[model samples]
Target: MAHVDPSAPLEGKASKETERKLKRESRTQIVSFVFMVFITTTAFLTVASDVIPSGFAIPFILLLASVQVIMQLYYFMHMNAKGTGWVNALIWGGLFVAAMTVAALMLLIGITKY
Candidate 1:
């Protein structure tokens, strides 16, 4: 038996299905990256420009941030892939708990005036 070098490059053309899948994945990643960059730019502009009032700008920027986070998780992190139902549920549950905790804290702070 001969030993195979793991570091060596693959020697043959990939199957059609594999090539198609790769192309689709690459396209998705590129689109997601571009969209994230656009979101970042929008957030920067929102903060930099004085035309948009703070009252509106703050929430708008936060909304954009949330969108970016979701996109990052689903696209960059591969959370949208198949067979990740349990992982998805756990992550979403965690996020829900964190959001609730923050809300509760904010309420307490408001009530205590601290």
Candidate 2:
């Protein structure tokens, strides 16, 4: 058996875990980027294609944009990471307020035919 130095930092074990975590995060980011790219291409194609009606394509693209935004916030912004509860709350609260404001405006101004 080999003698171990107690003074040495246990870099092997810690580094391995850190390496695995970084690999996982990198893979996730790549996948998210690819997905976002796909969504953008699809959105562009939808707009470019004459077969797709503007009404449906517009909403579909908006939905995809929202998905991209959510992924960006979670992955790139690291909102889902450690000790970001306040940030998450603030962001979500702002979204809620904005949504409510839009809804109220739509209702009051009769923006929609409904």
lDDT of 2 by residue, 1-114 (tens): 399889987664557888899999999999999999999999899999999999899999999889999999999899989999999999999999999999899898895665
TM-score of each: 0.80, 0.73
Alpha carbon lDDT of each predicted model: 0.95, 0.92
The numbered model that scores best in lDDT is 1
Error of 1 at 57 (Å): 0.7
Predicted candidate 1 versus true structure: per-residue lDDT over 7-88, tens digit per residue: 8897999999999999999999999999999999999999999899999999999999999999989999999899999989
State in Å the error of residue 66, model 1.
1.2
Distance from true position, residue 45, model 2, in Å? 1.0
In the predicted model 1, the residue pairs found to clash are none
* CA RMSD of each candidate after superposition: 3.7, 7.7
Please list all clashing residue pairs in model 2, or write none if there are none: none
* Model 1 poorest ten-residue lDDT run: 1-10
